[model samples]
Target: MTQLITERSTDVIAAEINAIKFQTQSMMLQASSEIGKRLIEAKEQLQHGEWGKWLKDNVEYSQSTANNLMQIHTEYNSNPQAFGNLSYSKAIALLGIDAEERENFVQENNVEEMSTRELQKVIKEKQKLEKEIAKKEADALKEKKLLQQDIQDLKQQLEDAHQQSTDHEDSEKEINRLTQELAVAESKAKKLEESLKAKPIEAATVEVIPESVQKELDQLRSKKNESTDPAEIKFKMRFESLVNEFDLTLHALDGIGNSETKAKYTNAVHKLMDKMRATLEGGMS
Candidate 1:
């Protein structure tokens, strides 16, 4: 019999709970008459923003408390074309028993407060933030353009400098090449002159150097013996020696006497000496 008593008690509690829920739902539906006009007036007063969506979600969650709000949320969400379907009487029917219940619902579910000025101020702040973002974007674009131009100018300057450096190097190399060529030409000219001096090549002329003429040449060869007893003879002898030495040293390479013809140098010297002797004898007399 103890098991039977426990089952009966459980049944009684369950019935009481069901009855309480029904009464609660009935009372909430009755208050909608007062709240219906107020809710519409609030929605119309403020331009809808995030708060509109918040209100809609809250109304959907209100299903556990009452049925009217849940139906409204479902209808609004499903059929966007079915607007303004709320009867003030129907919304008033959905209002709960007292202000305490409404305040608790608002607090727990984040019901938004309705103020046009506050909503408008928030919108203005958002717009200001958007404008600041646009300005920052424009400034960054301008800075990027300036940086790109600087990079371009640096590239041009680098190219010009490189060209100048290449030109300078080419010029220096050319100058060095020309200098080397000139030195080579000068060296060739000097080598030719020295070869000419080293050569003991024969001239075309054949001058006979007889013993008597050679001995006579030796006597009058020195510059001191050039002045003899007679001033005229001394002058003539000096002139002859001067002519011969000048021919041998200065004009030896010029074609004068050739191999085919010969001068009897001894006979000429004897003749000159005899003339000198005559002139001296005449002077002494």
Candidate 2:
């Protein structure tokens, strides 16, 4: 019982662990998606810079104002109106991107590439892997079920073989006993004929009761009755067939020798014969 409980507990733990891994995997992908969204949103606002050629080409501004705006932009972390408040669109115009090298690094990805076509390809692949894992788990379950079914089938076959052996043994015994009874009865009939022949023509013949004869008569009748009962006869016949079958099985198994099956079936056959004999006597008495 304790072992069974332990096995069940392990199975439950394995199921829980799988669930947690799947959920954690989803969360990790979601985090990656959040990073992609953040990068895209910052793209436009980082286009313009306060000290860029755009400012020199457009309105002439004091170097000090530009310098102050640059400080403000750095301080505000890319806000256009960094001094107080600013719209994201205006901020991006003044600061093109945070760093030219970093922006270039982000642009190296080929938009036409397969990896870039779908935003959620990684998640889809993860799901596909999960499906393959699930299929493997289901296959394991099927294999275990098949093994259990084989065990059950073997158990039932063992029982049947045992019963067959027992019935065969009983029939053999009954046949032996009836043979003895028939021999005795034939001897008595022969004696009776002899006595009739030896008697004198004028002498009166007296029949003699055999000594201790009740038991013998009962044995003879029982044997005849066993032959007449369809069920008993059927059992006897089947038992003979089974014995033949058992011999063949034993030969085949002996070639393979000392296997679990051989020992199991042999024991089953003995048990069945004993059971059958008991049942026969039980029914008679």
Candidate 3:
């Protein structure tokens, strides 16, 4: 029974110690919030240089320690509803987060129940995850922009290709039209050539006598018709036939190849015709 009582007492002592530790932690957090509030009030009332000197002289706390305590309280004191269960150290660890984040962080990680070191570790992991997510989002946005640019480039290329195709089609049509026009022109030229080939060549024909030569022939015919003597009539008829033969021979001279030969032949024929004309005139007289 004595042993049982000793065990029971030991259990009660442990519970009391735990309770005291809890109360102490709570008091420390409250003190931290109160200290932050007092510091703010003191700074408002005091000058900067005077406050620094007074803090160093009157308070045993160093500037840095005071600032840390003040920050911890500033972050959690006003919003004690969320951090009421956190110890001063644990609340200090959560000061890295904003007021809005603090409530969520406490709920998410059960920060009130966590040790200060544990809370810090969890925050570190959370920051790393957020950083990775931000990097992925930035990379995705960059890729999306690049994809849009590529699509625009492809669309421009397609437009250029389409324009080129249209231009080529127009060129082909022009070429075809020109080819058809050329064919038509060639056909017309060929038909003209064929028509020229089918027709007979114009023969070398007799040229018309000069007007002066025609008047002389008319006078000669009138004189012949007035002649009554048989010999005169015979001479006149022979003279007229000779003149017609001379004209026919002159027209035939057009076929001569050598100009010198043609001139010599023409001169000889003129001399012979002159003698015959003189003989006919002597007979008529």
Q: Estimate each model's TM-score.
A: 0.23, 0.20, 0.50
- lDDT per residue, candidate 1, 1-285, as tens digits? 455543568789999996775465445533442243345555566575744554567554232333444434433333322222223233233232233343343345332342334434544564566566566445435534543553454355445545555556654443443333333333333433442354332322222233565465445433221232345444544544444443344223333365333245535546776998899899999
For residue 203, give model 1's deviation from the true position in Å. 99
User: Is candidate 1 or 3 superior in lDDT?
Assistant: 3
Q: After best superposition, candidate 2 residue 101: deviation in angstroms?
A: 34
**For model 3, what is the error of residue 201's alpha carbon versus the real structure, in angstroms, after optimal superposition?**
99
Each candidate structure's count of clashing pairs: 8, 15, 0
Error of 2 at 274 (Å): 53
Please write out the lDDT profile of model 2 over residues 145-203, one tens digit for every residue: 54355335434544454455455766555554344334433443343334334432110
Candidates ranked by lDDT, best first?
Answer: 3, 2, 1
Output the worst ten-in-a-row residue range by lDDT, candidate 1: 200-209
Which window of ten consecutive residues has the lowest lDDT sum in model 3?
A: 199-208
- N/CA/C clash count, model 2: 15
| lDDT scores of the candidates, listed in order | 0.42, 0.43, 0.61
Q: Write the per-residue lDDT of candidate 3 for residues 69-125, one digit (tens) a residue.
A: 889777776776666667777877777777778788789877766778888998887
* lDDT, residue 167, model 1: 50
